[model samples]
Target: MKKHNFSAGPSILPQEVFEKSAQAILDFNGSGLSILEISHRSKDFVAVMDEARALVLELMGLTGKGYHAIFLGGGASLEFARVPYNLLKEGGKAAYLDTGTWAAAAIKEAKFFGQTEVIASSKADNYSYIPKGYTIPADADYFHYTSNNTIFGTQMQQFPDTDVPLVCDMSSDIFSRQLDFSKFGIIYAGAQKNMGPAGATLLVIKEELLGKTGRAIPSMLDYKQHIDKESMYNTPPVFAVYTSYLTLQWLKNNGGIAAAEAKNNAKAELLYNEIDRNPLFVGTAKTEDRSKMNVCFLLKDEAHTEQFDKLWKAAGISGLPGHRSVGGYRASIYNAMPIESVQVLVDAMQELEKSIQ
Candidate 1:
């Protein structure tokens, strides 16, 4: 049976990315060597790294705008610490908005460096909605927030208008939609969700934001060091960087972020409409805050769990279960997920309602 994938991370990628990545693994660029064996400093891999960084800035519309893009190891979790380490000065404050797991994790790390203030949060409501009307301390070094909450199925539809440097973790939603990329001082994302695979993380930083923290940042955690070395500060994740480059090429060929946003919006509407219309189902996140990337919902009656599970699975669906923290189902329709696959899940929902009636 043909499978429809909906896993949240290390998740679905363009079919061409899989094919090309596999080809590179066997005989990278016809160089007679596996991508796994290439030297990070080799000419071929260097080209890959260069193009990937440039493509990231291009796709984000940040090129020639004093922004630098770098692919790093240690995933985005590492960035939770590195961000504050390089940006928050000793005894200076940092501001954050806690909307989900990752945002809270970032706040924890920032606190270690200096005073970390959570100016707004939806944690009291189980992170089902985005907090509003919060004040960002103007004297703080930066303000950080997560763009999408994969586990809780919530997304921020708009960003705060603050003169404070805007730092965002766009892990699950990066490149899936269009945005004013210049508005952010820093944007970081784990590659597993929408960019590529799990081994690499992408960080785009405004050059001027660095060298202002007034603390001795470890070379590994310093963004300026990586930028100075052109993202080759140390050995990089070669395979992940190449695959991410391929994915970025794919995005550009398909009309860039504008086109991807349209498809993503369509997929979310199809699933959310069914969840709201189906008498046997209900959505988990607030209707206004529902994520376009991850659609989380549940059966109106717990008695129907087994039946719904069987229906989706039997129809060749996989990764339909929600995160343990938010039980029920989550259909992650990322940039690469076709509308046709969404229809399949919607059909399963309709089938459940029919049987229950």
Candidate 2:
């Protein structure tokens, strides 16, 4: 039986990527050494690093003139602090959109490093809708936001135009859809969810955005330092980067971002329509702000949670449980998740609803 995975991060990776990557580990391109055993400083591994970084730029539609793509450690949590440390300067205020857990955490980290303000939020509707129509301060250093709220299931469908730099934490929805990269000064996403594996994070930053901060930064904490070193100042996660390389290759060969976007749209629509059409299930996020990646829903009778959990498990499905904060179910359909898996969940819901009725 093929078990379907709906767990959010450290989530699904393409079967093809895994197959090629496993072979590479044994003997990479006739090098006769395990990918993990090779030195990251070697020329063989350097090509992998180079291609992985390059593919990110190509995937995002960058022309290769304005931005630098980097793979770094520490997940997106490090970026929460690193973003403000690099972009937020003295006497320079930054604007943030507070949507849910990740956004709130990013805001808190930024406050300790510099002057920060919350320009918009969805706390009023209990975070079901995206906040709108707020003016970004002209003096702001940069405006920061999370593209998709994984736990809450709300995505910023369209970004607000701002004059200052726009930075996004795209940890949950990276590569799941096509985005306008020119609109953002900096974009970062942890790779565990849609890209490849854990222990790696991707960052794309415009060249002009760095070096404005007057404060001194530690060698490792500085974005410019990593960029200057070409993400090689220290040894990188070799195995993770190799797997990501295979995944990017798979993406390129199987139709790049456009193909992924269409498939993601179809999968999300199938489940969201099911949620809306069913009387027993209720969607947490509002209509306009629903996420194309994470589809969260709950049963009408919260008391039947135990029985519902058993039914899904017996069906050989897993990871449909929601974050404790959301208190229901979240089916994270990332890049590698087959639409068939979604159809299975949809069928399960129909069966569960009928049985309950």
Candidate 3:
């Protein structure tokens, strides 16, 4: 049986990417050496790094536009500190919009570096909807936000227009949709979701945004240093970076972000339509703010949980359970998930609803 992967992070990637990456692990680039054992500084590996960085910029339409793309070892969690470290000026305020768990985590780290004001939050209602009409202070050095709330299944459809620089953590939805890359001064995302495997984080930074904080950053955490080194400040995560490069190549071959967004929207719509029509289910996120990547819902009749769980499991669906903080189901339909897998889940849902009735 084919498992329809819906786990949030470290989620599904294209099968072709997996096959190519696996072959590289055995004999990379026809060099008879495994990618896992290769030198990061070798010409072969360096080409991988160069192409990966270039593809990242190209995919986001940031090439030749003062944006520098690089891969780093620490996941977006480390970026929670690095972002504020590089952007938030000493004693200056940074405005943050708290929408979910990850957004709150980003805010917590920002406070350690400088004053952070939470301009708005949806936590009061269990993060059911994205907050709107919030005031971003003019005096803020920058405005930071998470584009999509993976845990809550709510995504910000519109961004704030402000004089201050805009920063984003697109960990769950990067490359899964069309975005105006010019709007953000910095964008960071873990490669585990919508990109590739775990172990690397992708950062695209605006050159002018650095050195404004005036705080002396340690060499390791300095974005400028990484950019200067061409993302090879130290030995990088070789395997993860290579796999991500292959995944980006796949994205380009499959028609880039516009194609991915169209497919993602179609998959989300298929599952969400079932969630709304199935008498036994109820969507957790607000209809208008629903995420195109993570579709969260629940059994309206908790008594039918066991039957529905078994039905989906028997149908080869996986990772439909919601986070512990939010008791429900969350189907993370990312760029690589096929419409056929979505149809399977939707069919299982309809079957369960009919069986229960």
Candidate ranking under lDDT, highest first, comes to 1, 3, 2
lDDT tens per residue, model 1, 177-281: 889999999999999989899999999999999998878888898898999998899999999999999999999999999999999999999999998899999
Return the clash pairs for model 1, or none. none
Q: In order, what lDDT does every prediction score?
A: 0.93, 0.89, 0.92
lDDT of 2 at 103: 92
**Global fold similarity of model 2 (TM-score):** 0.97
Clashing pairs in 3: none
Query: What local lDDT does model 3 show for residue 32?
Result: 97
Angstrom error of the Cα, residue 75, model 1: value is: 0.7
Question: Mind giving the per-residue lDDT tens digits that candidate 3 earns over 175-256?
Answer: 9888888989999999999888999999999999899897999999999999999999999999999999999999999999
Off by over 4 Å in 3: none
Name the lDDT value of residue 189 in candidate 1. 96
In order, how many clashes per candidate? Answer: 0, 0, 0
How well is each residue in 76-187 modelled by candidate 2, as lDDT tens digits? 9999999999988877889999998889999999999878999998877778878888888989999999999999899988887878999999999988788788899999
Worst 10 residues of 3 by lDDT: 348-357
Q: Kindly report which residue stretches of model 2 are placed more than 4 angstroms away from their true locations once superposed.
A: none
Residue 54 in candidate 1 has what lDDT?
95
TM-score for each model: 0.99, 0.97, 0.99
